[model samples]
Target: MKRHASFLGLCCLLIVAALLGGCASLPAPRPVPPTYAIQDVASTRLARIAKQNALPGAAELSGFRLLPEAPFSFNARIALASRAEKSIDAQYYELRNDGVGRQLLRELRDASLRGVRVRLLVDDLYMSDADELFSSLAAYPNVEVRLFNPLPARSGSLLSRIVFSIHEFGRINHRMHNKLFIVDNSFSVSGGRNIADEYFMQDGQANFIDMDVLASGPVVREQSAAFDIYWNSEQVRPIGQVASFDLSPEQAQRRFDQWVGGAGHGLPENERDALGRTSVAHQLDDGKLDQFHAKAQVLVDDPAKIMRGRMEERFQGSVSQRTLAVLETARSHLFITSPYYVPGQVGLAQIQRQLQGGVKIIVVTNSLAATDEPLVYAGYARYRKEILKLGVVIYELSPMLSQRSGRLGEFGKTTGRLHGKTAVIDDKRVFVGSMNLDGRSASLNTEIGLVIDSPEIAADINRIISIDRYTSAYLVRIGATGGVEWVEQDSSGTTTAVHEDEPETSWFIKSKNWLLSPFVAEELL
Candidate 1:
């Protein structure tokens, strides 16, 4: 009996081990497919200027506002403008419920009730619990909400899952990450902030940050046109309308009722109360809004319709065409703030040329500790050496550092994440919206921005964001040995070089990059 029992015990242990091992061995997700096509140099240049002068001065020079580096000062500068009152209201809010999200939700609800048309665009990556909120928002007569790309549905019945799996496998990875909120075509909010708790810093753990610049001018008209294009495009679709599972009009109505009735009050643990704030809460009430009597421009790009019919002529060359032009026109300095930084050989060349020509090129991006996507960082890391070599000043945001701690400034105790995409050049122009300096923003994802030609606004942006905050960010410096060191000053006033423990980034992460590199082309970043 003892011998038989021992054999059975051994067999059970082996079975358990196999089961756990199999679970652990599940393959990492496959990367999204290549989405950018290489284009001819000439064609690339044309596309850059395609949106140039579209709204006059839209091609102004622009710079970036990287975290642990700068707070958005452009908004404040506009707030300070004393020009002819154009009735342009301005507001600044943090990521927590105290600022943007709640304010946006309230405006949306009020607009709906008053029958003013409301349209919202959000990057699908952050749509964790927004589905219900969106569905509710869609119920109003003046409101129409669409999702960029939605998750594949699991069929209600066991048989249904099997039925749909064969046909629906490709819809999982690609998503719409464009973030824009347009109000009646007179005002719009565009930047890095998405409709999510992290973007709002309501998550408590991670300071999900991002910046959005609210603008009203002839530029808002362009933003409206851009929003209409995406809304009507096939890349986005109305929510809850997908056939399957459980969403019903009644259910949607119930959600709407709860959201509107309890507006501004209750939200899930990970969500912000977007509905509590009133109209333009952050800005001065009844104060005269800023006017953009100066030249302003707008640029919009997307992959939905392949203009010129050649895949190569599409999104891959979009930003380069425009950005290169902006650089060439820049006089004194240029600022760049992108969450993901992966300027390929060709793109980096232009930037290098600009730096050598005596243009003050400054870049603010996330450090490894602050970067949410490590693989993207892996690709960006490879270019650091080449970029810094060109004499461009680079600042990588430090993890958990506040804006006040150093140059970046003090961050809200629980809210801090730099999610702004901006560029300013020579105080003559500024670009702010949802485009990153990666392949994705270039070709795969649709993006939009405004080029403001107000030197006053530009100076304000530089002061609040660039000058004050960059001190806390890791300054990228090269040593004589060609070894690049991430330099940062600690509380003791000592500078140190940061290196990882593994000396090898985790094998798991490397393997992911290796497998995804082929398909994870930069244009679609």
Candidate 2:
């Protein structure tokens, strides 16, 4: 009887170990303190400065410039953080502890040391690895870091967190997808680029073709206000309260210094020199960086979007709604570029209606070989044939495009993937922001973007697209037999047929997509 009992005990222990290893058990929620508002601190400080200097009001026209090159975009962000005299505000969806992430953290820490109040808000879904870093940054008196929609168990593997929070998945899955960086409350950068090596062309394995707009006018005020809304929302929790860590200010400073000194040390000398040469701040100071004046409006989703059922009531004035409204007004042409393009039946119908009304529609999105999210691509693939039937033109970015053809010339041997989310209507209005044309973006996530009323900017974007799309992408069309075939253009402007959805994609990827498509829910993709 004793031997039998020992065997049973061993079996039970093995079962428990298996469960924990596979993330099959749910984790208990921990207690947290109540959240309070931080107020619009950055804007208030900027208002005082503007009044003292006799500057224009926050509602006046603003200056806007596009940062299409990744190196310049990264440099602009560093310059903003370095030059911030009073306050800095930033919010992002994902921030890794890799190359770009470390550099930004060091810059923010240095800015804090110089007496600049740095406030950062990041989505907590991907914060499992960065909890310690955030806690260390929060140790500084001048720095504050918050995580939006934090999980019940703050530290764990990604699968474990998902399984443990499975019951609350509906709420936890809704993330804040806004990417905004404001300095001194008077200048801001808002668009699709997150804080990562891929977004900034630093990752040699894969680089994202992204876009950002640097604004220094009335639009910055609106962006600042949106940041305040999310910063003060009850859904945001301080990183210190969520994760337990005890790092002294001195220790934090030492870590930051090491990170800063070691950053880019592995890069070749030419890449580093290229990065140093495209400094927008230096050009602006020397009266070389050109800018465009425009009337711009910042649109953001309600902070209550983090709430599951309450999101519908607040969806009326959301960024998605405003974007659809703008699309409805398009009469001549509509140009759209989204990395993840999963427009459901309703969106397709809307596009069909526009097509019937004689409007030309052109869309550029990631091909299966280039997309980082194959599941999302599966969801998008369901609509390709239906969209083609409506006479709309579609282009998928090539995964094997040469690095020399990339917007950032410094991207060495990196595979290019489309990450910019933009739309142009009738060459009169332009939309650039974090919103993707997918159901998740429309109903599940909170997004922010800018609508600029400037024909000059619109024309510039139209011209770029007209020139680049044919060279860097595969044009999808209906074949003679009524099936899809990809067409490509060679360097000599010679066009040829490539008869596959993604000719360059590996068989493993194709098989994975084929197997996963049946199980993936379109709304969740």
Say which candidate scores most in TM-score.
2
Candidate 1, residue 331: Cα displacement in angstroms equals 3.7
Candidate 2 per-residue lDDT over residues 1-525, each given as its tens digit: 000112112222433444653333223334554332233444454434333332346346677777777767877888777777778888998877788887888788888889888889998777766777777777776888988888765667654565555545556768888999988876688899998888877787888887788887667777877888888787787777667655677787565566456665222223322223435566544534445677888889987865747535545667887898887789989999998898787688899899999999999998888788877878898999989889989998886653545533455677788888899999999999999988778877789999998887787676656567877888898888888888887645468557655767888988977886776566566
lDDT of 1: 0.50
lDDT of each: 0.50, 0.74
Residue 258, candidate 2: Cα error in Å is 4.1
**Off by more than 4 A, model 1:** 1-107, 121-133, 154-174, 243-251, 259-284, 290-293, 303-311, 316-320, 403-416, 489-525
Estimate, for each residue in 1-525, the C-alpha lDDT of model 1 and write its tens digit.
000111112222433434432121112232322211112222322123222313455443222222211123222222222111111121111112233354445555554565444555443333434566666666666555555544343223222221222233233233354555443333455665654345534455555445556555456556556666666665554554432225565676676566546434322221111212222322333333332345566676653633334435655446435765765677679988877888886678878777768888888877666666655766787788778887888877765554446333234554244567778889768777666787655644556666677776676567656643445567777876678776665655356555432122356766765675554445434
